[model samples]
Target: MTQPMVKKMSEEQQHLVMQSMDMMDRFYDEEFGLLRSSGEESSAHGTRGSAHYALGLLIRQKSGDVERAVRVLHKVLDYQYDAPEEIYHGTFATQSTDEHPPAGHYAWKSFAPGTAYFLERTFEKVSEAFIHKLQEENNLLKEEADVKQLRQLFYASVHGVLPPVWISYDPNWREFIACVCAIASAAFSELLPDALIQRMDEAMERAVQGSVDRRLSDAIPMNTNIELMHIFITHYYGHRLKRADWMQHADEQAEGLLHEFEQYGGTFAEFNTTTYYGVDLAVLGMFRRYAFTERMTEIAHRLEHGLWNNIALYYNAKLENLSGPFARAYDMEMREHSSIGVFLYLLLGKGYEHLTGMNCESGHDPMIALLGIDVPAEAVPYFQAHQGDRLVQKQFLELCERDDPKANRNLCTASAWIGENRMMGAMSGSRNTNGQMHPATIHWQTETGERYYLRLIRRETGGDWNSHLRGITFEAEVTPDSLNIDVQLDTAEEIEVYFEIKGPSIRHQDIQPERWELPGLTCTVKAEAPEPTMLMYTDYAEIIYRYVPGKSENRMRFELGISD
Candidate 1:
């Protein structure tokens, strides 16, 4: 079989990749050959960040940069735990300082694939000078372990540490198996010992059998990122190993994902997420470059276009962030750097003011650039043009009853209204318990040139606000200027409604029992409950409305409106 062709990067794309690399350069510890952690204040070094940084350096194609990249890779390898007898034999720490030894076992999933991908691409496509640099770096790092030995160690560690459980047991099984495929593919290409290759091939067959037994490829409501990665890697390794079953599974899943996107008016179950969207984009780029079938390639292109369109639709140009009732998100606001912002910065180029700087989660950006994925030409206008008042409504499927596909229980809906000064959005029937789901959210520009945010949350009276209130049903009706929310508790457990707002300072008098007039907006609350108590902080404030089971009302209704 022929090797897949890597797409050529455009001049603009090359510039953006360099621009991101420049940002990463600021955090690079030249002496140690590692990257400092994500934030400006962080002094710790990250193993995954260092490896990804090396990938970015390889993209630069300078001999000196290649040498530096080799140094960084060598440093990263030193962090990997090599104790074959230990449970966490192959993993690197997510981040480490002088006081803290590397400890995260899950780090392998994040760093291994990129490292292996780098090695594979270098051996196959890079110049002899690059290989010599790698060899030189290896000799300096460890006299006995040459490039071949280094590759063998990497493969051994990964193969040893990966859990023996069926691939379908974990929600993120796709990531684990993909990492395995990456390393094995690299090892095979480099002609590792036949015994090791045999073991890897056996492992791959087991993983494939488990997936087929569980019908994972047909599973609906899978995490968008996981599904995309599954499609790409399955198709890739299938073609490499001449496994028709894996290829067929990949095609079926790709087609299903595309059909779902088209049928749902282009919505991801993990819709409007800041982090996973970038992962989805990166995997699509993989499909664009590596898929053996024409149909798979076409699906990737179309899905890429659809995702960009939705991003544009949700983006509030005035606020310089995506407006949401996010299906899942790490941060409420996009002023902070996130994976999606990295892609946007790449697409929009310099002077794109929304992003703060590069974040650690942007490890996918280098691969995205290398694969030559960019914002579709048609979607460009939405980002460039001024956005006016508009409402976007979408339907997405949530949890599915695996035994009965026709239960009609998977339907979920989300709506967003974008205005000149503010954007408001809400989602209904999302059962995500993870703190990532925001059912109702609003972002407005304050008169004083600051952006303010407000989100509605329901939690157990004193439980963590990030997590969902167990057995609670939440629904919301959203309009251009108002939100009507209804929350029902399953067990009559005492719960609290939190209106978390971030912006300028807010005083007690600024908020009345049913009304609030803050810096850039005014809000009037309509509820049967008593007045909310205030919890003020330096940069944000929260208003909590407590509810009792029988004394007041079991069902709580909130009518919140934004004033003109």
Candidate 2:
């Protein structure tokens, strides 16, 4: 929704926005400028821009600056600190940057997509870069029993080999660094020299000798955590890295991480990295091997579909609120756009495929995305159905602006676009009064009982004046005893029914029990009255609830439940 009335920035606001973007550009420029190790800690924390590295690489690829991009990526291996054991790379640490040793945190793990995007774009030259490195150092790989040659060869081919538990790395994160390292090493095969490959092979065997308990006991897996993104991306790139073969223990931990991550509502709150690798993790879980369990798939679905929906906005027009963790500093200007991009990537990449193949048990057919991943589409109809109130208001306002008194004064009804068994209201409206006299006759056109909303708000006007006419009028294609519509009122009132089609029999109550639609019970001294208790029918679509004074924001939620 475009804000027709865009607030012009004052001198102060202009300066503020510029300052923030300037800071953003600078932080990302410096931290991601080099391909240093994740262990390289920055003085600035959340501001450290690993995503920038990927972006920079992307720019380089498109702009034909491949050499520089490769050079930058290569620097990641040169990252050094006082203690290599503590692999914590972040620009900002609680300790001072002077004598205090820099923490070697693994920033690349979270920066998978950005890096993968860059690598994929530049593989043409990256292929050459690997060949260059492999051919350049040919002396190191001779199979000599000499430990010096073995250590040097190991050191040459590798960027840095840290322990399984990277102190600065996220404990639950998959092995992104592993993929990068694997690619770099494989590309540099000639330089890996036969001796180096042999030495590294021995080194790898020795590396794995720590036993399952030792590796599983690790946290953050910083020492050997890298290239996982590459491995996963390899799935798309024609190389399948086996998780079960790599480290079964890590996969087990990944499942736990996924569970705990879901508990946190899909926000990687515990892992404090600027990069949103959680998106990557979500995709990784969907792979055929991991299967990630059914729970993992559900998490991915919710994570992609979930966002803050304002009822007022949803009724008016569904707009998501991007007030969540990934909002980093919360630039409302691009928050929703950013989150939506990530969600769509996950949706098209996995969700669409998942949706297309399965039969939805919810009776309604699931819709797939542009890429056609078979995933059940979230039921957006629930919100759409109730949005008639919003549409009617909009229509009323437009009529007012046009000076169409006859049209403006006429009560506008919410309209629904029903499909098969489902009923949904894309827009809504009610009666518009003229000269203080509210119009009584409202015309509603419907092929079926697809959309309906009505409420008479009473201002706590005791029993005498409280009895007002607030009836829901319906024109159903096939009329039954009653049709359900979600409703909740703060006060008690009576409804007069006038059904245009078939019988005037609308059950209004018999529906889903879990949905709890009945609100409250109170008999008032109204002129035309029948003692009807407030209905709280849960399973059914609608509710009729009594409201409390001063607490008016409470809403009658209409949730979409799609079963497969």
Candidate 3:
């Protein structure tokens, strides 16, 4: 009986442990006396020898090295990486550039509460270690101003306590604060006073139910939809927020969310646009949580595997190598890097070969100019990059299509971009010779390069599309030497196009170019508004707005500016 048959572990289990260990070691940096990741120094962004919260997270995961991880992370928490705000210092490399000097002070909301979260979690693990705990007063506000400021910062993470729209948009604050909330709720329960925890619980509940909560909507919160949701679901279910028995209510909420996904699925494409990154978060949440529902289970599995398992197994990548701004990778070969990169490196793997770059002509690299991001070298996936789109398209056809043999099963969610936006169908994609579109899903082209964004609008009558119009669209006729703008606003249900000249000097009168149907509400009715000097960003959009005679409320607007 070989000593009562205390058999060795199976190969599969051993493999799982090895894979997990590999994941653990993937982001560590023995050089530079740091554990930072790559890309942090891709640009001259952060501090010298500054540590971030992500390092703390890695430390906590390792069972035996809790104290060592805590010490390293504490040094990081105190260090500054000179980003616009506070963030977890993990992936992106911080080059010794004279460009972004450290802001003299250590803050939390800059990189979104990523590092703050790490701190919160460390506080708890140390407590659980039965190591003497640091008093909240001494540690949490160790360097914080007043207790009110500290708590407000904490709440801001959860409540989205900031302004709406981009003009004043600050990404650092939102990201740091939100991650901090995740830390407190998910892994740092012991750090908070009982009273503070109760309040945090309330703030979280308000997150899911507060669609009308101005606070939640007005300010953008840092956090990907999937991560924020993970925290929310964990709180609601783990602590039993909705029901006497918490797990029961969580199960119910999960089921309802999944059902909502089933009911309203097709609209995502209709409402999604590249300009607004919010849609990405929502979609990420939907796919991660309920991916395998009757609709897209297999596709979801593939996406998950691609992001985590496949990507990490690739070539030696750098933090700055990624297109996104914040690098967290702290390596021996490099210094500060993108925090998001290293954090994602664990799940997505190291081939940030994707974040930056495009395949376009040099002088007319519109995407590069518009997005203001680095054009990384063209690279393929480490594993099976080509395997993605075709498989997803097939899955979408089979599982998510409207005319599938399985028939309709709702397949939509309130969270879906299409359902929420309820905008018009704006033309998108690029153009071809002969002026005929390449069957691109949605496309836009500005021959004159003087339009802010291209748009495609629709109407039912010879009146305003609706009260507030829907979204922006892309449709214009451009020639080598001339651009013509025409939009037929049709409110007649029979499709009508109308012309209007409003604003101080908008139009002398309305210009309606050879219009036939209301579906096509836009064409190049060129007047060269202000010479396209005003530019924020331009992309394909579909929307409708109410016309109030002289206001041009839902008016089709476009502008152009110089490119990089």
Candidate 4:
């Protein structure tokens, strides 16, 4: 196999890369040979962080960096639980301060294949003599151990323990199983024993069969990231192992996904998510690099560009964040270093320093770097371009009935008003909850240049507070400076309307019993409810309006554009 040619990083991209490396350096424990978990006060070493740091160091390719990276990799390998009888065998701990730690159930999915990818690229890029020197300096191998032996040792450490665990555990995520098999086929097939090879072959066959079975019975889109991973792995190993059946399956799935994308106005089911979008891009990059057919490669390129274009449209240059109505999000603000921020920082380069949370976690930075992916050049302007008052609206098809594709349900309608100094976005008709959906959100720049965020939540009083109100139908009418929301519930239950706000120097005033004014926004509730209560904390505030059971319909309006 030939090494894929990667474009040289721009000077700005290199600077961001260096910035990431510096953050890793601060969190790195020299004694433990690992990176401390980000955003945690403890001195715990993170297995994924260590692996990602090693990959970052390898990409930097500075003097002494490779030796340091090798040490980190070895330490990470030591953290994996090797006990065959254990349920957690073949996986590495999520993080640990203990020298020998128990494995995390899902850790092997990312780190194992990721580390194998690192070694595969390392072998292709580095010289044998240099590897030998690093091995000697780290005392990783005997004096006479050849490069082949060292590679075998590293591969076995990660992949050798995988088959037994994979078969016994029988994880439901076929994409991850396919990933393991694909990497084995691509990098370590020769090093693996015949028995192990047979096991992997069987696993791959099972995964493909399962995917086929699902497609036969279901037409709704799969999870965006996982589907792409499945496509890439199938196509990748299909070509590597010369399996025509797997290749055909991948092609069919790829085309189906593309059709969905076209049918839904180019947005995925998990649309505009801060965390999963990064994963989506990473897998798409893999397709560009490894898909066996030209048509698949072209599909990957088109989707990759389209996703970046969406990123640009949602990006708020003033707040240094992507505006929401996020279909899914881990953090409301990108300043906290949401996964998408990594890609934005890479794209926006020097001016995107406000996204200082680069080390928030070992995000897809390592994988993106390995794939040599970049944001489309055309979308770069929108990310940093001068902001104007504009309205962007999109409608996405979420799912359809199995019998009739035209009988579409769960249409996600989203709209955003990007202002000169503020942005507000809202979505309706989405059934996603459990805190993943922020249906209505607003972010503004205060007079003092501080950024503030406010989002709406509908919750049943005694139910899961993190989730959106269940058994309710809601729709939001959004304009340039205001949002009007109407919610209808199925059952008579105590409901809470929450306006979660986060920022500095926040103050609120009650204009009326049901109307309140904050730093840069105002809210009015028109339900059969008492006065809204303001709950203040150190870094955030929540305005809660409680309604007793009886009212099944409610209306609330939020007016933005108030100056600080």
Best by TM-score: 1
**For residues 232-265, could you state the per-residue lDDT of candidate 3 as single tens digits?**
3433334435433434433454454444333333
Worst 10-residue stretch by lDDT in candidate 1?
162-171
lDDT score, residue 308, model 3?
Answer: 33
Cα displacement (angstroms), candidate 3, residue 214, comes to: 9.1
Model 4, runs deviating above 4 Å:
1-10, 16-54, 57-221, 372-374, 399-409, 459-469, 491-495, 508-512, 522-530, 547-564
Could you give the C-alpha RMSD of every candidate to the true structure, in order shown? 15.0, 26.4, 20.0, 16.0
From the highest TM-score down, the ranking of the candidates is 1, 4, 3, 2
Evaluated at residue 317, the lDDT of candidate 1 is: 67
RMSD of 1: 15.0
CA-lDDT, candidates in order: 0.65, 0.27, 0.27, 0.63
Question: Model 1 over residues 1-564: C-alpha lDDT tens digits?
Answer: 222111246554565566667788888988667888866557788766676676677666554765686567556555543433322333444565622222334333233323322433343344335446666775443453354465555544543444311211232443443443443345223333454445445444544444443344233234677668767767777877898988888888888889888888887667887777877887777777667789888899888888998888888766777888887776776745366666776677667634635565555455566665557786776666546789988788764212223342356788999887888988887765556778889889876678889898777775676653445666887997898888766645577777888887767678876888888889898975656788888878888888777765666778997885
What is the C-alpha lDDT profile of model 4 across 99-159, one tens digit per residue? Answer: 3322333233233323322443454345455566778797665554465576556555544
RMSD of 2: 26.4
lDDT of 2 at 108: 36
Provide the TM-score for each candidate, comma-separated.
0.71, 0.30, 0.30, 0.69
Candidate 2 ranges with C-alpha deviation above 4 Å = 1-52, 55-60, 80-215, 218-245, 254-317, 322-338, 341-376, 379-564
* Model 4, residue pairs in steric clash: none
Clashes of each: 0, 86, 122, 0
Pick by lDDT: which candidate is best?
1
